[model samples]
Target: MPFFVYGTLRPGEHNHDLFLRARTRSEEPGRMRGLVLYEGPGYPYAVEEPGGAVSGDIVTALPETYRELLAALDELEEYAPGDPRNLYERVARDAVRADGATVVRAWVYVAAPAVAARLRAEGRPIEDGDWRGPGDSRTHRRG
Candidate 1:
């Protein structure tokens, strides 16, 4: 499955070059609905919410690197299957291509239920659901 990445994994961000540069088959602009973005330490977290949407990139990994990539990403997100202390939960969701012509099921690491609850009570959301924010120089938009 492709991954819908909205934070450090997006192009030009710190983790992109380190983890995805040569491991992906393709990467393109995409959007996932029903989620909101929250600021994390030097990163961002997507928390599920009604009427919310997030901008990101849909990354398809090369067949040869898929399993390795998945493991690496899980580690990066600090996700472990069925773990109670998880910060993020890897869930599959539908994401639309930038042109809105295609929709694909992709993996999205969203805040765990406990984390989401705490974030709802105290976290700062990126109102527009974009991690890059306006005029931020760290990332560039691409289709």
Candidate 2:
């Protein structure tokens, strides 16, 4: 499955270099609906919401790197099956391609229920949904 990454895991971000560089088959602009981006330390968290959307990339990992990448990302996001302290939950969601027509189901790290509640109550959301910002000029290399 592909992954929808909106924050530090997106191309040009620091974590992307450490974890995704040279490990993906493709990385392209995509948008995930029904989620909101919230600030979290130096990264960001995607909290589920009814009328929101988050800008990101739909990343397909190379067959050889898929398993390792999935484990690495789950660790990075602090997601563990049924873990009460988990900050995020890995979920299958639909992500729309840049053209806005094609859609693919991808793994998305959304804020855990507890985290989402807290964020909904008081966290700061990235109003534009793009973690890199509206004037972002970071170029992404497609695999």
**Please, what is the whole-model Cα lDDT of each candidate in the order they appear?**
0.92, 0.91
| Per-residue alpha-carbon lDDT of candidate 1 for residues 60-125, written as tens digits (9 for 90 to 100) | 999999999999999999999999999999999999999997999999999999999999999988
TM-scores for the candidates? 0.94, 0.94
Q: In model 1, which regions exceed 4 Å deviation?
A: 137-143
lDDT of 2 by residue, 1-143 (tens): 99999988888788999999989999999999999988887788899998999999999999999999999999999899899999999999999999999999999999999999998999888888887775544642221
Query: What's the distance in Å from true for residue 73, model 2?
Result: 0.5
Q: Residue 29 in model 2: shift from native, Å?
A: 0.3
Residue 34, candidate 2: alpha-carbon lDDT: 98
Q: After superposition, how far is residue 39 of candidate 1 from its true place, in Å?
A: 0.9
Return the TM-score for candidate 1, rounded to 2 decimals.
0.94
Candidate 2, clashing residue pairs? none
